[model samples]
Target: MTSQARRKKVAWGITGAGHYLTESFDLFVQFKDTFGVEVSITTFVSRAAEEVARVYGLFHYLQTISPGDYMEEVILESAQGWSYPKTGRFSRGNYDALFISPTTSNTVAKIAYGIADSLITNAVAHAIKGGIPVFLVPVDIEGRIESPVPYFINRDICVGCERCQEACPHDAINEQIDYLKCTGCGLCKDICDYNAIQGGQVMLVVRDIDKQNVKRLRKMERITVLDDPSQLERALRNVLTEEAG
Candidate 1:
């Protein structure tokens, strides 16, 4: 049997779409239990994802379970404040596969257009450039999906400290909140000591191009597209089996 230290590694990137965020973590837990010491799993998350996970009440699951699996921190900024060296793990052969789950529409658009502004986007871009295989699970693949929307529960409790605004990665919070830019990560609710924030659900309407772009992504070389969250375990099994062969 191969030693745990010598096990192949997988880089899992989480984005800020609440549609399947909870399902994604459940899939990861199963992947870890099945793979055992055969694979090392590290998770990288976007700023928006951090917020969304907190909003959806799944961040605690990630935080508590990740350390045991060698999961890395939730990366909010670029590695060097400009470029993402975390992708170096893939470039240097440290990571055998790249998996991005519950991919936000914003991330899909960025990847489709070859944009790499955020950590998740940059990691995917670099992995593709390096000829590494990428597994993507886009939330808005076909039609409308339910997503979370977070807001202040009581204006009276808000102290005008701007902590929630600062915590928001998408700049979605201002004197007036911008729902379109919000990822609904719900970090603000945790940050607000006064208990002034709350999370709600809304249906996110996907545009024609949103669906078309994801379809186009499926045609890309070395990119395995997954529409169902349950397929994640199957996909990881395939990757590990291929490597073992």
Candidate 2:
């Protein structure tokens, strides 16, 4: 009888940024499907990421993509407490590598400054302390990017009836959409009688401060900074190969 090769375990983290959320998830699915025999993945999703994923209509896909075959588990921040006890696994060397893709600027700054309040940031901290290689694909790494706007209100089409506001469960709809409060539930859009609610893509210019944060993260030890999410496959392949060797 022939024995199967050991699968490399990876910890994948997702933040709230919508810039490359879909792309990252697609790549993740591809990696697992293509390299299931050689690598296994466990996904860690932040609380904000859950909301953003719903907004983009990818939340269900994220949950089902890893059915305990190629992917091991999907850990959610909402399911964890303030201390995030699951993150202790990283410190225990439970994973071979940690990869965070479509990472938001907020997350990048927090990690660069050593803040570990959130689940994703806490995982990165513990992973680094445990000597696990950390790879991040920051959404705001480039000077400019075309990002998807999950929801928006058109003033010209809105009748000020406030129906959309009343239908919003998250209180995300006021004078405008407060993205932080929104979960992309589409309640406001559904209740809007004026057809003012809309969604599309928009061009965003990266801030100087965010670029500097990426620079700082790049200088951090044991960390690999990637400007594009597409580069993640190559990076992960290289790491797994090196580890196997």
Structure candidate 2, residue pairs in collision: none
TM-score of 1: 0.73
TM-score of each: 0.73, 0.82
Per-residue lDDT of 189 in model 1: 72
Candidate 2, residues 17-112: lDDT per residue as tens digits? 989998998888888778766777888999989888877767776654456553477889999999998899899888889999989999999999
Give all candidates' CA lDDT scores. 0.75, 0.86
Candidate 2 residue 1 Cα shift, in angstroms, is: 16
Which segments of model 2 are wrong by more than 4 Å?
1-3, 68-71, 158-196
Lowest summed lDDT window (length 10), candidate 1: 70-79
Candidate 1 shows a clash count of 4
